[model samples]
Target chain A: MLEVKNLHVTVDGQPILKGLDLSVGAGEVHAIMGPNGSGKSTLAYVLAGREGYEVTEGSILYQGRDLLDLSPEERARDGIFLAFQYPVEIPGVGTNSFLKTAVNAVRKHRGERELDAMEFMKLMREKRDLLGVNEEMLRRSLNVGFSGGEKKRTEILQMALLDPKLAVLDETDSGLDIDALKIVAEGVNALRSPDRAMVLITHYQRLLNYIVPDKVHVLAAGCIAKSGGKELAHQLEKEGYGDLAGKTGAAA
Target chain B: MASETTTGLPYADRFAAIAATLPGQSVPWLRELREDSFARFAQLGLPTPRVEQWKYTNLHPLTKAGFEPAVVNGQGRGQIKALQPLSSLLPAEEPAHRLVFVNGLFRRDLSEIGALPEGVRLDGLGEALASEAESLAPMLGRAVRSGDNALLALNTALMADGCILRIGRGVSIDAPIHLVFVGAAEETALAFHPRNLIVAERDSRAVIFESHVASNGGVYWSNPVTEVTVEDGAEIQHYKFQDESLDAFHIALTEVEIGERGRYHSFVMTSGGRLSRQEIRAVLDGKGAECRLTGGYLARGKQHVDNTTEIVHAKPHTTSKEVYKGVLDEQGRAVFQGKIIVEKDAQKSDGHQLNRTLLLSDRAEIDTKPELEIYADDVKCSHGATAGELEESALFYLRARGIDETAARRMLIEAFLGDLGEDLASATVKAALQRRVSNWLAAI
Candidate 1:
């Protein structure tokens, strides 16, 4: 469902992702793990089409189409979702209204009839129950004064509502407590199905315990150092990236 | 009466022709007041950029426009031909006492005044002056002296028609009083000065909604001065919307004085006019008095909108709060000057003021000045101002959720302005103003 071929990205004229290649098939979940400043978030932002992440070389293909050619909103409407590592605190915008607008926009782009207020509320109630998100949180301004756990849970809620074909999770578990991590993982696990792919970018293997991934790759020096099955995550978690540091010619 | 020198008077020739036809000419006190005001205005002339208060805004365009007085054009009174489409800001179904004015003239045919409460005087200033001129003598211009501001003097000298509302002691009016002032296009550019006086007696309560709108395709100037007196224990919520034509100039000033334990709150939104300035000066005169001034403005194209406010705390334990937000796009320009003063006797006074603006384009500009002068050591007074473009992260967050770019920007701007209306007491006026903001966003 997603393919990145020798992708080299730069931000502020400094190269961050150099010759990075990765591929994920439909119904597969891949975990990309790296230490601090190893270009983990850079890869996520590049896939999400964020500005300032200039692609200096190579290309990204999603479902056999050039993903880099589409704008951020176009990528979103075409079933690509990016859960921001740090969700912006937007005061004055009601979370419920924002969610409704996003849901309607995506639905319209998919050739589906827009849901009325009543229908949308019904759907929101169901999703809220599944993710343990209460009505009060949605009534307040978007992520303003929200706790770290609440923000992460809301990101999951948005993912559930949009139901994107390819979901990019950027540090979703970085600030979450154990309870919030489980809730977020449960929400993500429920959405796992055929014809849908998800990329989990994390600095720790703690999240892999809740929702196991089919593959794991260690990113170092702006490129993937090793790719293996799920067991590689446990190995890296136990031994750290000390052994891979010599190959990448950088201190871990 | 045209002077020979350049500084003779800004509008001396024009004021000379319309002085005889002004309202309240027969009353001796009113006549002297007009003459004195005209002389003061002649001395001050037009405010130049050299003046400290008028540094950011230039009145050169207004003077060069060569606008004649509307009263002399015979358009202040009688029936107007194109009055059908000019509607009140309030909904038709809402119960309101409405007074309509066209070209600064009271239009009895267009005004819809319901049955006012007992002892409440709701009528035109022209009518009030014609009958029982003594009743309005002490209250008119009591909040602000004409000698303090040149534009106030100009308005006082050539005032023709406006709304005169007087609420008796302890009277509480449930319905809002609506004042609609429309400037209709004519053969030549016209200027009109409307004088408004609102007096809420001790313990009285009322709300007033004032709207200044202009008909399409007119180069007119609407110079209005409104004075409000909130007596001891009285409460008044004064709301105004200035939406003149895109080719027009709007210069308005409102002065309010609150007595012991009185409450005065106001919100003025400006989204129209080629060049406009809305200045408000409020004073808390007695102990425990309160004042809140909040508003939002939207400007685009070559429009220039200015909001200048001053709140003075004169008595101990008085409180004042102000918040103003604006959005400017294209080559639009805006100015916000907020001054807060805590006098020596105003010990324990609490005052806070905040002004934030969003500039949507590189060419859009905003000049904000927040002045805080506190002579009392025990008072808590602070002010802040901020101007910046929209947050790119916020915009990208909204668009990442499938919302289009335009929709995202609108949502953020709406949120920026909508937060200011959360603390408003009147829901009806809040909704009306919100609708106006939405309409302005749609146009931009």
Candidate 2:
């Protein structure tokens, strides 16, 4: 469903993702693990088409076409989602109103009819219980004064709403409690299907116990240093990245 | 003070006689107030180009136009309905009290009232001064230099017809009192001053909504002053809406005094008039009083609106907050100048002010100044003013979400203004403000 060939990216003229390659087929869950500065977020931002993060070279092909050529909205319409690590606080904008606009935008881009308020409410109720997000949290201004856990849960709720083919969970589990973490994981696990793909980016191994990935790729200095099965996550959690320091400069 | 001259214009004598009556009032204190005001008016000379507040809004056109009062014609049912925006929002069918002043004259034919509390007095200012004059005696014609606002002096000098409403001690009025000022056709250049005095006595509570409506292209000048006194433990909510024609000019002054444990809330939504100025002075005379001034303004065309507010913490433990937001379009200009003063003895004073302006067009302009004068040693005061277009990040976010750029911008603007209205204690009033906001946003 997603393909990246020798992708080189830079922010503020400093190279972050250099010659990174990755491919995720339908229904595949891929985990991208990296050290503190291994450009994990840089890759996610590049895929979601955020401005100011320029792709210096190479291209990102999604379902066979150049994904980089499309605008962020167009990319979402074509089924791409990025759950931000820090959900933005937009005062005065209602959370439900924003989600409806986003959902309809994506749907409209695909030649789909818009949902009325009634239909949208139906969509919200279904996602609310599954994501464990309640009405009180949704009634407030979009993410304004929301706790970190609530923000993450709300992001999962949006991910559920968009139901994009490729979902990028960027440090979404960083600040969640264990229960919230489980709920977030279950929300992801329940959405897992052969037709959808997810790239779970995380800093700790605690989250891996909930949503087990099929593969783990250790990224160091912008390029993948080590690639292995699910057990590689356990090895990293046990031994740390000391052993990978030698392979940091190894050939791709 | 050089008396207003009929020297150049034929009907100038009427101006002198009307201006002289203020100096002849019984109270020596009132005479002093009028004389000082006349000096200020003469020196100021109807706001020349030098004055910052009147720079964009020129009053010369109003001064040069020959103005003569038209007779108080009978109220037109169809006409009032067309101009009234408060019809549905008001309890018109429930027989609530309403004081209607059409063309600056108190109209009893169009007004209704119910039994009031023992000490409550809702009557025309003249009648209130004639019979139950004691209630309004203390507040009838006092305009302070607290804010250095010259318009208040003009209103005090040229005060014509309005009402004095006093909700007596410990009285709580559930029904809102509507003070509607309608400006009918003015064959000649017309100048009308409507005065409203509300004294919410100790432990009393009430809501007073004063709306100014006007039509006709004939040059019209409305100088209105509203004095609200909230005694100890009283709560007063005042709403002032200005929706005059583009050719008309409006100068409004609101002076409020809050006693200990009083809560005074005032919101002024100015969306009309070619040239409109709203000057508010809130004096916290007692300790532990709270005052909030929240407002939103939408100016299009060559319209110019100025909202100037000064809140004084004269005693300790006083709190004041001011939030003024403006959306400017076309070549319209909006200005908000708010100052909070915490006196030397006013310790533990909390003061917060925010003035935000959104310029929808490159040609539009906004001048926002949030000032603070603090003499108290221990106090918390913050003032912020921001001037910019819509956020590109937010706009892009909404656009990326499929919300059209125009709809996204409108939504953001509505949210920006709605925050102020939503802070009202009464949801009904908030809803009314919201409706007006949406209408204005949609029109712009």
Candidate 3:
């Protein structure tokens, strides 16, 4: 569903991602594990078309089309979703109202009928129950004064609502407890289908234990140094990234 | 009377020609008040940029325009009807008693005053002066003085017709009283002065909604003065909406006096007119009084809007709060000047003021000043002002969710102004104001 050829990226004139390449087929889930400064989050941001991230070289193709050419909003309308590491707090903008606007906008772009208030509420309630999110959190302003677990759960709720073709989870397990991690993992597992793909970016092997990936890739110094099965995660956890970096000639 | 060099005012000759035809000319007290106000206006003249109070706002446009007194009668009814939609900001659920005025003259035919309860009187100022002059003798020109502000002095001198509302002691009004002023100047550059008096007696409660709108094709000036007195244990809520013609000018002054244990709440919304200024001065006369003043303004396309307010705490155990916000775009300029004073012996007085502005364009400008003068050691007072562009991260967060750039911007701006709207007590009024804000956003 997605292909990256020698992806090289820079931010503020400093190189972050250098000659990174990866490929994922339909219905496949890939977990990219790396140490600090290994360009995992940079890859997610580049895929979502964030500004100030210069593409020094390389290209990204999604569903046989050049994805980097589209604007961030257009990419969103075309079914690309990025779960932020840190959610933004927009004061005074109700989360319910914002969700309705976003859902309607994407539905309109996809040539589908927009849902009314009642229909949208029904769908939202169903998802909230499935994810164990409270009703009051959905009624308040968008992530304003929210706890770390609540923020991460809200991002997962948005991913469930948008129903994107390709979902990029960026460090979704950084600040979550065991209960929150299970809820988020259950929500993601429910959305898995034959036509959907996901890329999980993480620093630890703990998250992969809940929702196992089809393939695991070790990212070192902006490149995929090793590719293996789910056991590769346990291998890295047992023998840390220090031995791997030396064997793979990784800068880190 | 027309000393051009010494007076420095260009409109003195025009004022002289219109003085003879002003309302209540037969009343000696009214005539003397006008004379005294004229002398004060002549001596003070128009405020210049050099003046400390009027530093950010310039009066050159008003000085250059040759504005004559608007014709009191024979204004086309069709023109007045055309401008009614602009003045209708009240929601349908809340029934209101409306008093319509055209060119500063009362229009009984267009006004819809439902059955008012006993001990309540609402009518035209001219009619009240002619019929019940004795009762109104002590109330007129009592709260507002004629020395410091030149525009207030001008409004007092040429005051023609406005609304007069009086509630008896302990009476409570369920419906809101609306005063809609429409200006239709089609022939010449015209100016009109409107003076409104609202008095809530001891333990009385009421709400007043005031709107100022103008017809499409006109260059006119609407100068209004309003005086409100809240007696002991009384409560009053005042909301003013200003949406004049694109080529017109508006200047208004509102003076309020709150007695012991009284409560006063006011909100102003400004979105139209080429140049506009609304000044409010409030005084807490007795102990344990509370007051809240809040407003929001949206300016664009070279428009200018200014809000100046002052609150005086005269007695102990008084509290006052003020919040004003603005959004400017396309070279639009906005000014906010707020001052709070805690007098001597006014112990335990608490006061707070905040002003915030959002600049949408590169050339837009905002000038804000929040001042506090405390003469008592036992009082708590604070003030703050802020101006900046919208947060880029917030914008991106919304845009990344499939919303376009323009829609994202509108959401952020609405959120910024919605914070102030949430403080309103009436749901109907809040919905109406939200609709108006949406309309303003759509227009831009």
Candidate 4:
């Protein structure tokens, strides 16, 4: 469902992602494990089409479409959702209203009918119930003064509402306690289906323990140094990137 | 359009033409007031960018056109018009007592004054100037000075007919008194000034709803000055809605005086007019009096709107709070100036002010100033101002779900203006303001 070919991205004229390549098919959950400054978040931003991130080389094809050529909104409507590591606090905009608008924007792009207020509320209630997010969060201005756990849950609620084709969870485990980590994992697990895919980016193996990954790719420097099964995550969590530094030595 | 001038123009002399049409009332106080106000008007002259209050908002586009006073080619008053909001959001039908004005003339036909309780007098300014000089002449110009602003000076210099509502002591006006001001369009560029005085007597309760709407006001100028007095223990709610024509210019000055234990609430909404300035000066004259002020502006196109307020706390235990938010789209410009003062001996006085702006386009602009002065040691006062574009992350969050950018933006703006709406004393007025905001946001 998602493909990145020689993706070289720069932010503020500084090289962040250098010729990075990765691929994930439908129903497959691939975890990109990297240490601090390994371009994990950069890869996620480049894939989701954030502004100011210059993709100088190669292509990102999502479901066989040129992702780089699409606008941020267009990429979103095309079923690319990014669960931000730090979800933005949008004052005055209600959480429910934001979700409904996004849902309809994507729905209209996909030739679907827009949901009215009542219909949208019902859909939102279902997601809130599934994700265990409180209704108070939905009523308040979008994420204004929202707690870390509430913000994370709000992000997951949006993901559940949007149901994008290629979901990129950018370190959803950060800032979340053990309980929040489990809830986020549960939300990700519920989204697993045959026709959809997700890319989980994390620094530790703790989130992997909850949402098992089908494949694990070790991102070193700016490129993927190795790709293996979920066992690679456990190994890295045990020995850290120190083991990769020695193994990929001279050749890297 | 006439050439723009800094000093004086032909329109300044047109005041005599308007004065000639008003009822002949040359009482000593009236003559003194007219002469003094005329002198003041001539002294300050037409407002220019040199004045601090009129700094960001220029009156050249308005004064450049030598329009006859709206009083000259005036159309008689007709039926009152509904607001721009959904009808369900407003109170059904006009209230019990209403005073109507057309081209600055009092229209008793469309007005309803019988709904007021006994001992209440809701009369026209012209009639009051002629008959009740004993009751109000002493306090008419005591509230505001036109010298501070040229348009206000213009209003005083050209004052013709308006409204003067008085509630008797210990009386409570259940139905709010509505004052409607509508300007008529004519061949020549016209100017208009409608002055009003609202007095809620001691221990009485009254509400004022001042609605200003003009259809093709002929690219003319509308200058209005309204003074409100809340006697000891009275409660007052004042609402001002301006939906003037795009070519018209609107300058409104409102001064409010609160007595001991009295409460005053004022909300201003600016949704129309080519260039509009709303000046609010609220004075807490007695101890334990409270004033709550809130307003919002929804501007689009190239319209320029300004909301300026000056609050004074002259007594102990007086509390004042002001909140204003606005959404500017296209090339619209919004300005906010707030000045708060706590006088000596006004111990335990508390005051706060906040002004925020949301710019929807790169071309849109906002200038905000929040000033505070405290001479009392026990006073607590503060003010805040902020202006910026819409939050991009919020937009992306909404669009990613399916809401089009337009709808998302509308929702955000509505949310931004929510708290201010909820502060309205009347539910209908709040909903009406919300509807206007929603319509403007939808169009934007």
Q: What are the TM values for chain B, all candidates?
A: 0.96, 0.87, 0.95, 0.92
Q: Name the better of 3 and 4 by DockQ.
A: 3
What are the Cα lDDT values of the candidates?
0.88, 0.78, 0.86, 0.80
Q: What DockQ does each listed candidate score?
A: 0.88, 0.33, 0.73, 0.53
What are the runs in model 4 whose C-alpha is more than 4 Å off? A116-122, A243-252, B1-7, B14-18, B72-96, B145-153
lDDT of 3 by residue, A36-144 (tens): 8878988988898888888999999999999989888898889988899988999989999999999998999999999999999999998888888899998999999
lDDT of 1 by residue, B207-249 (tens): 8988888766688888999999999999999888888889999
Residue B98's C-alpha lDDT in candidate 1?
Answer: 84
Q: Write the per-residue lDDT of candidate 1 for residues A164-185, one digit (tens) a residue.
A: 9999999999899899999999
State candidate 3's DockQ. 0.73
What local lDDT does model 1 show for residue B373?
90
Q: Which ten residues in a row have the lowest lDDT in candidate 1 chain A?
A: A243-252
- Give the Cα error of residue A236 in candidate 2, in Å: 7.1
Name the candidate, 1 or 3, with the larger TM-score value: 1
By summed lDDT, which 10 consecutive residues of candidate 4 chain A come out lowest? A243-252
Error of 1 at B144 (Å): 1.5
lDDT accuracy of residue B27 in candidate 2: 55
| Candidate 3 lDDT, B200-231, residue by residue in tens | 99999999998777756577888889999999
Give the DockQ ranking, best first. Answer: 1, 3, 4, 2
Interface RMSD (Å), every candidate: 0.6, 2.4, 0.7, 2.3
